[model samples]
Target: MTSRMKPAIDIIDQRVRHAMRQVTGIEDCSAIVTPATNAKFGDYQANGAMALAKKMKTNPRKLAEQVIEKLDVSDVCQPPEIAGPGFINLRLKPEFVIESLRQMHSDPARLSIPPAEKPRKTVVDYSSPNIAKQMHVGHLRSTILGDAICRMLEFMNHKVIRQNHIGDWGTQFGKVILALWHVCMAIDVHKKSYFKNDFERLQSNKDNKNELYKICMQIRDRHDKDYINDQLEEFGDAKKYFGRFLEKLDDIIDEIWPDILLAYRFVNLLDDILPGMGLRIITREKKDNEWKPVERPYEHLTRKITVMLQQGGEENCQEEDAWHSVKKATMEHCDYIYQLLNVTLEHPRDSRGESFYKDMLAGVVEDLQKQGLAVDSDGAVCVFPEGFKNKEGDPLPFIIKKSDGAYLYATTDLAALRYRVDELKARRIIYVTDSRQKLHFDMLFAVARKAGWARDDVELSHVTFGSVLGEDGTPLKTRSGENIKLRELLDEAIGRARSVVEQKNPDLSEDQKQQIAKAVGIGAVKYADYSNNRTSDYIFSFDKMLAMDGNTAPYMQYAYARIKSIQRKAEKSGVDVEAELKDLTGIEFTQPDEIALAKYLIRYGEAVEMALADYRPNFLTNYLYELTQKFSGFYTNCPVIKAPPDSRRQRLLLCELTAGVIKHCLRELLGIEVVEQM
Candidate 1:
């Protein structure tokens, strides 16, 4: 007898293309079909003909008929037919689907997603949380999204470089340093207060120190604003010239530094001078003797300011220039968070704030100016892209060089961009940041394009994402309105998972709970983050995620455990499953459920290939979930253990395949390990 088999996907594709040529009057017309959204509609559906019909100004049903007649896929599929409105439905031959499965089982990297025609280096910049300040929900989306994209691209045979563009340099460091040095009174204070401290003590210290420094900083900043307001008051008669006076003050400050410098005492100068808005520094660093000016009084002013920000200032200097001081502070409570939550990250790069970029700014500005992409606006250098608009819908510029020669995020990004493309030779650069910066990226891309740095050979993409919201649909925040810390959130998840694990399996030792809780909790959270499409927002919910039911990590994990359980039972019974597939030519799927389960068991490579094509791991997640469910159905409907010896071994082989697929899916999707037992 001649053996019957299924045609591979490529064969079907070619036959469909050939049929299109023979049946359609228009020789150039072709169709691409996708799996039907609903199984009731048939295995595959092609709406391409209807779409073409719209463009050709013809009847869609007639067009679908022509395409179906031209299609030559009789070997792999039944003849296509026009369905509702104009969709062409295709039912694949079962023999072909089954043969494809057998081939996949024998091949190593199974469903063989072809390599890129010409590969290019891709740099993924993500997980860029700032140092010192605790990571919050803001960092969660980017870190997870970036990691997922990198994982997908790598699986598809792309060279992916991972970059943790940590906020190592920035003003927040200045605040923490100044706060820690001064408010805590001594460098040793950090160790003394933080060591062995409980969460409450840490929380109290962080709140107190941040609030205290903020109030003092506020006094100076408010004083400056008041000074600006007083100037405005004096121009009441010339109200229309209000902007002119503000402009004059902006210009005068540069030329009249001494007058402004002397107006405040040295201590007050430090408070005002260090970068920050309310209670923060723009960026702070150790009081370095090398960077300080060698002139008289300027040295004394810098030192005194440093002390005021670091080791609490003498109470007598409230009148000092606010701009002359640097205050250092630490989020003392963050230590407790790390302890309670049980997660640690490498120390962030030593970036205090904007001041860290001060030197780099000059190089970036000069480059932009030389490239003719930036022009001086007022006193600052700026780059305005073509279509960006201001509040009045007038064209606005992206401020790269501040009029006072100050550098902002735009300038820093340009420097970073240059470093990425030039030093790294990254043909593709993907920035995983908040969607709120859409306009910023657009202008940045335009600037790069205009500067001739981003050519057809080099590509820049913004993988933007939506916010993580609370149960109430607002940004997830603490009760006191502070953004919840990322470390704290993760810790709570682990703790909750520990509780669940202990309740479920009380026989487990303390060490097991510790290890398993990390997996379960972290897996649940990461899976929740990833299972959703990256561009949409999802609510932060532990309870919903932890329940190992209906599309969850635990559900997939449990399915893997079930297979391991069966494997153990087979071993105990001396079933000898190893020799089962040696000559598997006569394997039979006698039960309806067995045949159905076998179908899913054999399609792992196809699911993975689909996910690789779209860069979405949710496809993998859903696939594993359904595979597990099918296995459950098979177990209930078919008696594997009591079957004839050969049949039992065949079923055991199926279980082994299930375990492998589950483990692969979890490890690839959420970076979780599968356990043989609960």
Candidate 2:
């Protein structure tokens, strides 16, 4: 393989820092080289001498002159000049600029960008959708942002392990299984859509408690009857009926996937209202060598089922089968979303959910107890990591195991951390979650380090982002105040984009229009999220995102498509664009626009490095937007096909490089596609 090319800014920074080290006799002196604010001064300016002189208590201007005497950038830059206040201004030589562009043109795969000097195995955990639930608007930022982080790191030659820590275990599954059983019972025994009707009824009557209580009572009565009748059937247990239902679970999954959310909500409503209603239900438990009958409160049914599922064995085979079926259905839903969004999470490979670490929870608690880091607090096993306090001025507990013998999210996260460190051999682990979980991760990292599960050298980062708000400055939701489903949101975006494409270029073929619509629609949503700072909340607007002008995806896509059009036109006019670019020896920068675009083109690697440094995609987007504007200027002022014979190849070369950079950054790094024609 060819060697990677070091970025120009990095080279300049190293040279200036080396010169500073020689002048001050400091082993670790830094030259903070940044892009010049004004092009009149220079392309880049180093502002380190002033700070160093102050630290050493010497003349700033004299210090800059001493550093310049030792600076040797003759290969890339012109003579370095000391500007006001000991600032060193340096401009790239024309030959150096031409050589950089030539190198980038030759290396199309990576744009001649070098990998990191120290590549490490990095684990990024993101897009953790719960089992038996549809992903909503809340999951948008983490999913795309985390995917971009992985792409950039991998492009920089790091071994990236993508973890989809889905919520597949715990009390939720019991309710889900119960909901599934209700679906089966409604279809098979009652020959009616009982839960579907009850779901709507509950929603409509939720405000009237008396009517809601009446509905809950009616549902509980039927539930109790079904429970008793199944146990007293010819098979002598509920297994035969549920087992037969599980045989055709796939067909049922397709039928109920759309209604699973409704059924789940119905169960939750019942669980909340059926309590303290003095209702009872019959259940079975094994005693000695026979099945014995037991009665429990109606509301406690789901919890009992949860315990049964957690304690896996031959008798609980029905629950196990149901759990697997539910998980399979839920993941299929999530996989569709991932594919739709162009995300890189593959099912069963990148998916290591909470259930994967179930067996290790006990061992984690036991080890913490042995290490004197865990103790019983209010009947729960807790570890009070230092520096966290409650409002009452007491050390807050990081509860691992609850008083009811249930493991919390903290326990699973700790187990996951240990696995990533020891098994995956990850030197750095990033958790891409919302800002609300900042305190949780803070305590998690502290507890992990205190328990020696995460070594000091291991880098643990909680990459938090702000929420996507509606026009009203609140979290985006449907008219019913429910989380908007991700699938529906994306579909609406594509639908809206289709209309725009139809109006703009109605004569295009249907297939072409569809492709453009998909690209523009999906790219717009992703680019809008990426353009904003991850730490600041921004209002989500389809109108703003889909506009044809201003820092939007449609604008960027259109820019790339325009360049492609120019190339095609050149080909039709008997211009062998490929041969010209390949045979080109050097590029002459005669116009101001040409020089401006060329200078910015060589700094593509700098943009990638800055984005990777802070795990922010906005930095990359900002660079691309600026590049597009510069290219626009060049295209308007310096015509490509109409240029003179000598300048033709240089203009074409600029177009090729501009298109190449935009496509790589958008499609490869950001997981957003660009249309060849729009």
Per residue, candidate 1 scores C-alpha lDDT tens digits across 569-644 of 8777876666665555656667767776766665565566666555566777778888989988988877666788
Candidate 2: segments with Cα more than 4 A from true spot:
1-3, 232-237, 271-299
- Model 2, residue 334: C-alpha shift (Å): 1.6
Worst 10 residues of 1 by lDDT: 321-330
Q: TM per model?
A: 0.73, 0.96
In candidate 2, which residue pairs clash?
none
Summarize candidate 2's per-residue lDDT along 590-630 as a digit string, tens digits. 99999999999999999999999999999999999999999
